[model samples]
Each structure stands twice: as C-alpha cells, then as structure tokens.
Target: MQLLEYISFLLLSSVKFFFFYPVFITKEDYNFLEAMTFGLTAGFIGSSTFIFFGDVMYQFFHRLALKKAITHPPKEKKQRSIKHRRLIVKLRDDYGLWGIAFLAPILITIPLACILATRFYHNKGKILGHFMIAIAFWSALIYIFKSSLIHLIS
Candidate 1:
C-alpha cells in the first residue's frame, strides 16, 4: 500500500513536473529527499524538453497554423507582435537558465517554452544543461526547506 502510494505520488509528480513544478506536490510530501529529487528532475526535464523540442514543436505548430489558416482564416488581427522582442531578449540576457527553467514554467506552458526557445535560437545541449542546473537548484531549495520544517515539527 505504501509502495503504491509512493509510486502514485512519483507518477503524479512527474506529470505535474512536466507541466509545472512546486505545483502538484503538497506540503505533506515535502520531505528533504523527495523535495530535492522532485525539484531537480522537474526543473531539468521540464525545461530540457522545452528547449530540445522547442524548434521542432514550433515548426509543427507553424505548419498546423498554416494548414488551419488555409482552411479557415481568422478575421481578428494578431495580438502579440514584435514589440515584445526586446523584452524577451532582456529576459534571456538577465535570467538565462533561471528564466527558462524556473520562471518559464510559472509564466508559460511547456509549449510556450518550446516556442520561445525556437524564437531565441537556443542551442539544444546548452539549454538542456541549463535546465538541469536550474532543476537541481530548485530541488535543493525544496529539500532544505522540507528538512528544516520536519526538524521543527518532530
């Protein structure tokens, strides 16, 4: 029963991590080791997947959009324009790995991350490394906090 629970938790965590970390997991689950592993893997996989498949995903979407447009063109004008390019650049410059791995999940979805990576022309391997590092940092923080809380409570 306990094993099942743990496995369920891990699977849930992984799914949630794919979309958003520090999200699906509850406070009760925040043991030091669990927190560390969750945060690290979540951040790494989430961002790395985004970065690696970013361009490919973008192309796929683009093709889809084109097909859709051909079939049924939208009447409304596009909302997002080139104006935000500078802001994106600034974010890329300032936050870099942290921005993509940590903030991206909060601000945008995995698909969006892939889109942004494509737009920014980020290198696949480098982005993966950055994501992994960011995950490690986030996981470490979670672990430390959980450990402290456990100590206090026990």
Candidate 2:
C-alpha cells in the first residue's frame, strides 16, 4: 500500500519534486529496494504519459486557439502569454532540446517540461525518450544518495 502511494505520488509530482519520498518511505519501511523501484517506475510511466498527453492537448488547444482567433479576434492584452512566449524563446535560443531534457527531470515538473519540449521540438518520441533517460538517471542517483544518507544517519 505504501509503495502504491509512493508511485501514485510520483505519477502526479515531478520526479525531482518527489525524489525524497522514497527516502522517507525507506526510513519507515526499511525497504529501500522496493521504494526505489516504485519511484523509478512511477517516474518513467508518469513522465511518459504526461509528455504524450501534453503533446495531444497542445495540438488540440493550438487548433482551438487558431479557430477562435479566426472567428473571435480578441482585443484583450496577452501580456502573460507574451511573457511566457519570450521566456520559451529565450530558453530555446540559449539551450535547445538537450538543455531542456537534461534540466527537466531535476529543474522542472515533467508536464511543464513536456509542454515546453513539445512546443519547441517536432519529434515527440525523441523528446519523450530524452525525458525518460533523464528521469531514470535522476531517480537512480537520488535514490542511491538519499538511501545512503539515511543509512549513514541511522
């Protein structure tokens, strides 16, 4: 049950965001292997699903936005969107997909990363593959370090 909870949490939270949960669970359950397994599996599955879904939703919303713009031209200021677009453009210009892939697992939530990646990159599979690799690497490193720290403390 605890393992289920941990995986479910990882599914919703970013791999980095909930990376320490496994440590806590290990402390309580003394099941480092199980916790690590759940965490890693959850990170992979959750991030993959999120990335794919984000791509689909982005396409849908993009089409919807175009249609809306064509039919009902808005007069409202898109300050927030403009700001976000600028930020994304800056990130794209500065770092590109590799940077986003490397940083996403640790620096940002998976869904947000997926959305950004999808917006910038045309290859969904490639982006998702990079995200999975990042997640796996981070999950393993975090689990090892945290579990070892817990062991040392105990």
Candidate 3:
C-alpha cells in the first residue's frame, strides 16, 4: 500500500510537472526536490512543445476554427519600429538558438518560438535543441536555489 501510494504520488507529480508548476508545488505532501523536479519537467516539456510544434498546432486549430466557421475577433496590429526589427535581428545573429530558447520563454512563449523558427529558419530540430538547452539552464538554476533554501531551513 505504501508502494502504491508512492507510485500514485509520482504519477501525479509528473502530470503536474507537464502542466503547472505552482499548482504542483503547493501540494503539502510533496517535498522540495520532488516539487522542483515536477516543476522543471513541466516547464521543459511545455516550453519544448511550444518551440517545436507550436506553429503546426496553431495552424491545425486555425483550420479547425475556419471549418467550424468560428470567427476570431480581429487583433489590433502593432507596428514594428525599425529599432525593434534591429533588436530582433541582433538577437537572432548573436544568440542564435540559445538566445531564442532562453528569451522566448521569458519574453514570449514556446508557440511563438515555433512560429519564429518556422517563419525564419524552417528548422524544427534546431529550435527543439535550443529550447532544451535553455530548459536545462533554467532548471539547474531552479534546482540549486530550491536545494539551498531547503538546506538553509533544515
């Protein structure tokens, strides 16, 4: 029964890791490391999926919506200034994959990354690789901080 309970906890943690971080961590039963792992994994997977297949998924949904004749309210168009374009180009040239992976999750979303990858380079593998690297860096930072906090408290 204890083993069953542990398995149930792990499963729940994994699912929570894939969807929401704060929700998983708020569970009183989960220890620090368990919660961190769940949060990191969830963030990684969510970010990766957004970076790799976001555009395709968006298109699929868009097509479905069109078929269903569901009208999306039109969005206001924001003009991109020359400076903004220059900044984007600089980021693309300087950071390449790593820049996009790191900044996208912070500034945009994985889906936006996917759109950028497809629209700019048309390379899904490269986008995924960059996103995973970014995830690794972010996860490591989170893990270290969490461990330090636990150590300090204990």
Report the number of the highest-lDDT candidate: 2
Q: Residue-wise lDDT of candidate 1 within 28-147, one digit each (tens)?
A: 466556667666665555565556666677788889999999999988865575557667788889876558656544455544654575576556676666556655665566556556
In candidate 3, what are the lDDT values of residues 7-126, reduced to their tens digit?
554444323332334333444435656665654565555655655666778789879878766566536534676677788778789987677768754565555665666666666677
TM-score to native of every candidate shown: 0.64, 0.67, 0.56
What candidate 3 gets wrong by more than 4 Å, as runs, is 1-23, 26-40, 57-83, 150-154
User: What are the per-model C-alpha RMSD values against the true structure?
Assistant: 4.0, 3.8, 6.0
- TM-score, prediction 2: 0.67
Query: In every candidate, how many clashes are there?
Result: 0, 0, 2
Best by TM-score: 2
For model 2 the local lDDT of residue 146 reads 70
Arranged by TM-score with the best first, the candidates are: 2, 1, 3
Ranking by lDDT: 2, 1, 3
- How many residue pairs clash in model 1? 0
Please list all clashing residue pairs in model 3, or write none if there are none.
17-42, 50-110
Better of 2 and 3 by lDDT: 2
RMSD of 2: 3.8
Clashing pairs in 1: none
